[model samples]
Target chain A: MDDQDQQLVFINWLEDHSASVMKVARAYTLNSEDCQDLAQEILLQAWRSVPKFSGKSTAATWFYRVALNTAMNWKRKDKPRRESQQPLIDINVPEPHGPDSSERLLHQEMIENLYQAIHQLPKTDAALVLLYLDELSYQEMAEVLGVTENSIGVKLNRAKKKLATILNGGCDES
Target chain B: MNLDEYRQAWKEDEAQMNITFDSDLLSKEVLRSHQSFQSMIYWRDFREVGVSLVMIPLWLLLGSMMSLPWTWYLTIPALIWIAAFIFVDRSRHPQRPSHPGEPLLFYAKESLEQTEHQIWLLRNIFWWYLLPFCISIMAFFVNVAWNSSDGLLGFSLLSGIGAIFLYVIYSAVYRLNQTAVTEQLEPRRDDLQRLIDSLERETDDENAGDIMELVAAISESESGCGACSGWLNWAENWNRLVPSWQTATAIILPTLAGALCGWYSGTQLQIPEMGPTLFQVIVGAVIPFEIVFFSICWSSSKKQKKIQVARDEEAASKPEDRIKTTSSDNGIRLPKAPALVILVLVIFLGVMAFVAIGAFFLHMKEDLNAHNAQVIKRSFHCTNRV
Candidate 1:
């Protein structure tokens, strides 16, 4: 495709699947401003790399690779934002307002806490955990992460147990 | 919480609101970042070339003041070397294709190649950089010696020794840089290589031409963790040749004894000039090494004393006086030449006195021996006087 055509195609691709990019950036960064910055950079990189696309893999596969690598690079380069900076905006995740609302709120809190725990992880481990949470099949994970399909089971199990420990210090017997 | 249950919620709850980027600005930003780095490298090279140009006249002035005809030739090669250094530095760093859009593999490969290039330069630096300079310096010294009528044999011997010493130091530094590269940067590069290879293996695409280009880019550098130590640090802790060299008894008494032994040996030799000259040269080389080591130790100890006194006063003083002074505001005081250096100087003067007396004695002995050797010749001399 011509450069303009490729750019248009990539933007359309981002509009459809850019949520994954956001997930990766949110998993990596601590604050909204940093997340927005990282997300923008990831899109910019994905757009720039369009010329080199071999097209053997689906755009989604390529996007994940680019996104994960960009997120990893961002984490590597930037220092942690100073803690004394204002505390993170509270998740005003819709106050419980109906039957079954309490359980939904609890699940929301758990997921928020899970993201916090994932961010605490070393960047590589965090990347693995993020892929697992995205529910990609082990074979798909292998393709995205360049791990053996067999090894994904072991890695995911380890990441899951670590996540469990991080979530509640492994006290949740269930 | 089992991770599988969270997947649906992760997809839904963490779904981000739409964000947009202007296309034109981003492309410029990436190119701008790359350009900035290139500019930095160019300026650094320009500064080095400028500094070398500035120093050329100073060297010529020195040569003229010293009335040396040969210094002009030396200056030309020195200027050429400065130019060559800039050229090699520029040419060695081939433009790394660092377009922001390139794969992580591209960057990893570039880093690996850059490190390898550094390793190559550092290892072979003696051959390409130092050898030519050494040759020119030896030629200059030889020419000076020939003009002055110094014995070629003695001059050659000293120059040969100096050449060997220079090579030994250079080789040692090269090996040290090499070891650091292998130990520190090599493994880091290898880890990166393994990651790249793993990614390639899964792709089933045989485009490992990137890997093949690595052959073109083969090199490494020790970022910091190396075994080299400063001279003072080495002497302070690693020195084993003379423990007493740091103490009053060792230096003072040995200074006197070395002088006496040397003077006695000179007097005993009776060969005018050669005996005393030999003693002076040996002592001369050793004295510089001794004086530097002594000064480093003396200066360090004096600083420690000053610090101790400061601490004691700080302990006794009110909080305001005891407020630790900022290093810049308190100014780093240069250490005075210790009384010990003066004592060493005195001992050196005494040794010179003894050496002079010994030389005089040798001359007197040679004169007397010649007078005694004359038999009938002396009687003829007396008759001429009458």
Candidate 2:
């Protein structure tokens, strides 16, 4: 309604979803420096586009869409980044007992594997997995993608199978 | 170990992170963009808006003073003010110089390139082409009020011929001066072009799609795409005629017609019986026509010759250079001896008036109108020597 009120809401929304933005940037460029630049560019575009935003889709969904589109279409004029080769972080595996310390370290390792697995999925499918993992409703994900809610479920299922196959070292197909 | 656990961890990680944005550098660059765009949009055009504001009051004062029913002497201030404003405005707002650091040779080349469009706008309109024509019209009305017996015939002929003469001289002089200016302006035009190009390149990287689309649109209107060689040829020869005595003589035809009318009027006042003579009719109609004919003929001849020469030269030159440099920078060459032609024409007109008076005296004597002949002779004697 007012400038300050609008700005506060936008900053709160942007800060809450910055990890999603960083994940999209990481997909395009695994190198930390390049990832930071890509993230900054996405933020700049989002800031410039803020005045045009109308209250239809939730801010988080809109932010997710903008970040995803930037990463997918990001054609760097300089050298393109190489595909990331780092091992995937394993987020789902529970630790076999050691101490609470060992359990926390295992949990961190699992979260790191999950992020690496999301980065490895083909760019579009990786975005679907990230949003699906965040528990975005199929309708909200569809609104962000400008597609039907049914398509979102189909894409999310496909993305999950793809991620699962990447995480499992091809031991299991979907 | 479950999908729900992974989803919760991801949302928590996103919520905990911070992103910072700094746009100061970008804002500064956009501010410094193109100079021509800067000047045209913000500075030079801004002054034009100022000029328009100043002009409103100036014109209003001028209109009130000129239209006010004061004695003829009171209008002199308004006339002087208008004349002064014209001179000041011309000098103060001389055309902006071309880019800086461009060679003098290139300046001259660009001058010639821009001559036609510049001259056409300046000569035909900007430099007040209509002012003299409008003045001549006003003069016709004045002449009518002063002497109704001669009818509108003499005044119309005089003004018509005079207007054509002024048009030729104005056009010629403007073109000639244009040549000189182009020679002086080479460095500036080059600098301006370079600045524009650099700005374009900067914007190109930042806005690739928008810049590419704009450049494509501009390329469509480019001068290089057609065989405009002939037009340049015409411009060059028309330029040559500017300084010639022939142009000056042509421009003075109206004054000559006016002088002839004065002489006829002086003599007719003496010999009333010879007022409607056949020679007078021929002189009145044919002389004005001849004056207009000579001015048009001279202007055309020079234009055609220039075109022919330019065509040959342009055909030999590289197509790319011809496109970039043609028609934009030709400085108008000022004519030498402008005053001499004007002075000579004025004197010649005076002499023609005496000739008309003498003819009236002769007609009266030959027709055996002795009283009228003596009166015509006395009037001619009293008038200063032709």
Candidate 3:
């Protein structure tokens, strides 16, 4: 694709699918700054990858592939530095604004707990869980992860059980 | 809440998580990052190739300026070979394909392949990187030295020093690369392999039997069965007959002591006609010193065996008790006498052996010299009388 075409497609795709990018980045990083860093990296990689898009898979699937791969490799390189740095408080927690703000706050807390649990999973499992929480089908998850659909079922089942256990205050097996 | 509720909440929260980017700025930043990434890869390649590029011309310049022999030009081919070899090897194992859009397995496998190729390049650095340079450089030095005024002596001295210097440098380079492979690349490769393995592992019960068989095969190969196990056990028993430190000390300490003693005796205790040379005394002292050292080792080994047997019995009788006994529980034992006494005895024996051997050889030489003189005198006298 030409630069102009690539830019147009990328901006359009970002508009529609920026949620997946943010979710992936948040799942991979601890705090907002790192999440933002990872998100930007994922976007950059996605933009660079736009020229290679063959329309073989859906744009969401292709973008998830780029984002997750970028995040995985980034985490691998950043692990030492991340491990050394003290985790900053997450600043991206949503403020409850509606009249049923109490209920919304509870839901927000649950989501926070869920993200913490997801962080405790192995990188692949964490990616699988993110895709699952995003409501991707087993086929899409398999495509993103490069595993068979059956393997996805097995792994996702295992990851869900592990995530539930972590949520329930059980030890992480990661 | 159920997972469905959580999923709903998660999707609902995406609206609250706003990530706005200015498209123009984003494009610019990405373009810059892409350029930087491309340059980083190019920079790495340049770092590897730049050394040869600089060195080849520099060496040529040096050779011409120094008026080195025609053989010095041979280094050009050798240097080019090194550069070409690096370039070809690197191109053959180009950086992992940047297809981030591909599956995780593909990326991981590519990363692993790149790491393995790096390891291969480093592990065999001697063949491609060091040896050719070593040979070509040494050959040039030898040729220059040969054509010089002093000839063989000059050649020997210059080449000997050059060889030592080259060895130090090449070995250090070899070690650094090997260390990089071991400490960095190998671990990275293993991590990638593990990730790939986890992704590719089959969850089907049909493959369970194959995995079990593979595990069993590995275990059998490692532990061995029947006669092989017996021999391995026997070898293990003999291998630790004496503790490693004890064995090393027994060998190294005595040799050092014998050499020191021989050096002292050869230099200080010179008997004009009967004194041994340093080399001869060292040979003589080393023989006796080794014998005495081993005798001490044998005595210690016997004591250790007795202690081991007692410990074994104790362990067998109290299998339920987890705490184990160690031989060092008794005491730290050295050769029965004080160190001073042992040293004195060792020195005495070594010196006596050296003196005896030296006197015998010196006496035989003296006698042969006298007989030759006497024979010459008799022939002269007979000639005069005739």
Best by DockQ, which number? Answer: 3
Instruction: Give TM per candidate.
Output: 0.50, 0.32, 0.63
Tens digits of lDDT, candidate 2, B1-386:
45566666666555544444333432232222222133343433335445544544554454354332223223344444444554464455344333312222233334333433344444344234445434543454344333322446765665566567666866677666566446533333443344234222322231211111111111011111111222332343334444466766566566456446745754565445534343354356346645664666677778767976775465334222210111122233222474345545446544554455445434533544465577789989889575
Give the best candidate by lDDT: 3
TM for chain B in all models? 0.45, 0.29, 0.50
Model 1 Cα shift for residue B343 (angstroms): 40
First chain of candidate 2, TM-score:
0.75
* Native-to-model Cα distance after best TM-score fit, residue B237 in candidate 1, in Å: 33
Output the better candidate (1/2) by TM-score.
Answer: 1
lDDT of each: 0.54, 0.47, 0.65
Q: Which candidate tops TM-score? A: 3
In the range B87-155, model 1's lDDT, one tens digit per residue, is: 777576853334333344555566666666666766676766666666765665555444433477866
Candidate 2: misplaced stretches above 4 Å? Answer: A1-6, A77-101, A170-174, B15-386
Measured against the true two-chain complex, the DockQ scores of the candidates, in the order shown, are: 0.09, 0.04, 0.14
Residue B160 alpha-carbon offset, candidate 1, angstroms: 8.6
- For model 2, the local distance difference test gives 0.47
